[model samples]
Target chain A: MPLGLNFTQIFLHLFNFLLLFAILYFLLYKPVKNFMVHRQEVYRKEAEETSQNLEKSEKARAEYEEKLAQADREIAGLKAKSGEEAQAHYDRQVKAAKDEAEKILRDAREEAERQKAAIVQEAQKDISDLVTDAAEKLALHQSSQENFEKFLDTVEAGRAEAKN
Target chain B: MSKKQQRKMTVIFVVIGVLLLAGIFLTAGASAQEEDIVTVIRDAVIHDTNKIALFGLEVNPGLISGLAVTGILTVFALIVRIFVIPKFTLVPGRFQMILETMVGYFSGLAEDSSPHKNRLLSAYIFAAGLYIFTGTMLELFGIQVVTTAGHSVALPAPLSDINGAIMMGCTSYLFIVVGGILNNGLGGVKGALKEFSLPISMSFRLFGALVSGAIVTELVYYYTALSYVVPVLVGVLFTCLHALIQAYVLTMLVALFYGEVSEPSEKKLRKLAAKAQKTEVRTAEAA
Candidate 1:
């Protein structure tokens, strides 16, 4: 027959186990549990914060992208507007210079015509006066012989003066 | 549908088929031996240094194998490591910000536990605990697969074997070492030891409770001539309670120990940080 474990021995053994557990529970178990719970709570709080941060970052990213797009559009629009303004100013300046040149040419031509007309009139008047003076000297020489002689002397003298 | 989806579906099917085949093999093997797993656990407990009793009764081998203490710890560790830890970690797609937050929080924990704001010790403890628990549980479950798959492979005994004792001992030692290292980094070796004692008890207390619970369950079943259901139910209840209580207690003790260890060094560390901050401010002002 096997030496079976008696009921009393078994009972005592079990009781001893429980007593050990009770002691450990208080000394080790309770404290450890509390620590774990505290850690877990801390973890949960952290997790919540992390989730919020992630959401915030995502939102910030979206906003940034939107702002970037808006900035790009604004920059492009300004560039186009500035380019058009600059081209317009250049074109206006070129057109004004061309008109000024035409006006100056017209004024210069008119002034040259006026100076040429005055010179021609003066030359015609001088030519008529010289012709009349020459005719009068010839007529005086033909009037009388003695007077003609004197006139001839006068003509010769006039000739000598002209030569000198 | 698409090629990719088809490929995924095929992979899924292959995995399912493999799992089914493995399950069948395991069941066939188990049916052949039909030896109760609980018997092995009971014998193993008897061999351990911890002689725990429960409820004024000694439990049987059947209960021991069915409700093993180390096995429970392994399973819990696995679930937390594989499921909970990863969920908390949240890499790649979901909650990357959350992961960073967790990292920052643990970094703070490291600062609190150490004298010089070093996170090495705290991070190491967390990772080691996570890994140890995960590895042990996976090993246990992997052993179960063999048992069920018509394989003759036996489960590793937790007691009487040098390996088992070493593994369990190392686990406890790791907790102690981590605690000590954190304090040592902060307040020197002597202070580390003071802090290490808290975690040592944390690890040992669980083992004690588990052993006690198992022994008691066996005693009740055999001595009192109680109904089969009653013993099993009581054993399960006590075992769960013991595990829960141990986990909770260990956590609190470690946290409190952290607080205590960090207290003395506070003044010196604060002064150093303040001086550093002041220097930085002055430099900035000058610049």
Candidate 2:
């Protein structure tokens, strides 16, 4: 055969090469490729799950922070409102106490003045009675012994009347 | 010139002068009896056909060499499949890294050339690349076998036989045709048919490159004077270059042509245009 070119050799070479190709395809290429693809998919799935979990936690944290901030605002507002109410209540109570104290002092002063006036009227009446007695004694000096006895009897009757 | 350059030039000239003198002496010392150049050429070109009678059928020696290569490849593949591949981890070992790099290189070539048909094409290219690379480099081992005629001969690269190259070329063409049909239907068939000369060109290219290297190496060895240093240089350079370049060339051609033929045609364009129109209408309505 010129340069080893023959139908038989060509056909056999073709057959041998094809057989090798088939063996390699089945043995080496398929399995390694499948393994790589499967590993890639697994890694992708894991990454996705991790990312999703992170996002969920972030959202939950944000919601919690919002609620906490809202709570703080409400507590502050309530504190201010309550503080105003307490101050108003304190002012009203103080004003009421002051007015009541003033009323009590005025009533006490009036009662004390009435008692003083009554005492003074009684003293004046007593002073007028004593003065009349003194004048009667001076005018009765004509009958010495008889005038003295009459004055004594008159003093005793006045005392008895004052006592009654 | 600098001192260093002047010194380098002087050394180069001295080496050349010595080589020329040695050449003249060697030629003068050669025997007067001349060898037949035509006989040497014939011996270089022709491989002995040692036929095996398999069920009353004749088998060629080239085929025998092809079978040996195939057998070696099969056993290697089987070993890797059972022992090496199974033990492969996410972090590759040295041997595994070499295998992965080889597979990855061809796979990347397929993907870059034909993204749509990357799956099928990559597998095919990987198989083809391995076959060519291993088949060519197998000759470097210089394994010889005794034929039925009691004549011992060194096995040649499978592609050194024109039949093997033709087979590979035709097979690659078949893949390209199938890829086209699958991707673009009738248009793909027409496209593939237009490139009918592809198989012929591919076969001749592979066969010619490999045979030329063998012929040159044989010619170098045939000469007594030149055989010592020249055969080593020629054989190594030619074998390595052919093995690598032919493997890359065939795979690249297959991928490039497959990609060209398999690209989607009128129907895909229509679908794209329709989708764009629908989007436009929706946007207008929203506005």
Worst 10 residues of 2 chain A by lDDT: A134-143
Chain B of candidate 2 versus the native chain B: what TM-score?
0.77
Cα RMSD (angstroms) for every candidate in the order listed: 17.9, 11.0
Interface root mean square deviation of every model, in Å? 13.7, 1.9
Leading candidate by DockQ: 2
Off by over 4 Å in 1: A1-164, B1-186, B195-204, B220-227, B262-267
CAPRI docking class of candidate 2: acceptable
TM-score of each: 0.34, 0.67
Off by over 4 Å in 2: A1-4, A71-164, B1-40, B43-61, B147-151, B223-232, B268-287
Q: Tell how far residue B217 is off in model 1, in angstroms.
A: 2.8
* B156-255: candidate 2 lDDT, tens digit per residue: 6777767677788888898899999998888999999999999999988988887787677656655657655565678777788889999999999999
State the DockQ of every prediction.
Answer: 0.02, 0.38
lDDT of 1 by residue, B1-287 (tens): 99999999999999976876666565553433233436534543543212224354343222232224334544544554445444442232354344344344444565555544343334433433322232222222323312222433223222122222232333434444455455545353456465445433543454455455545654544333342346446655654454445433443344445545544466666887999999999999999
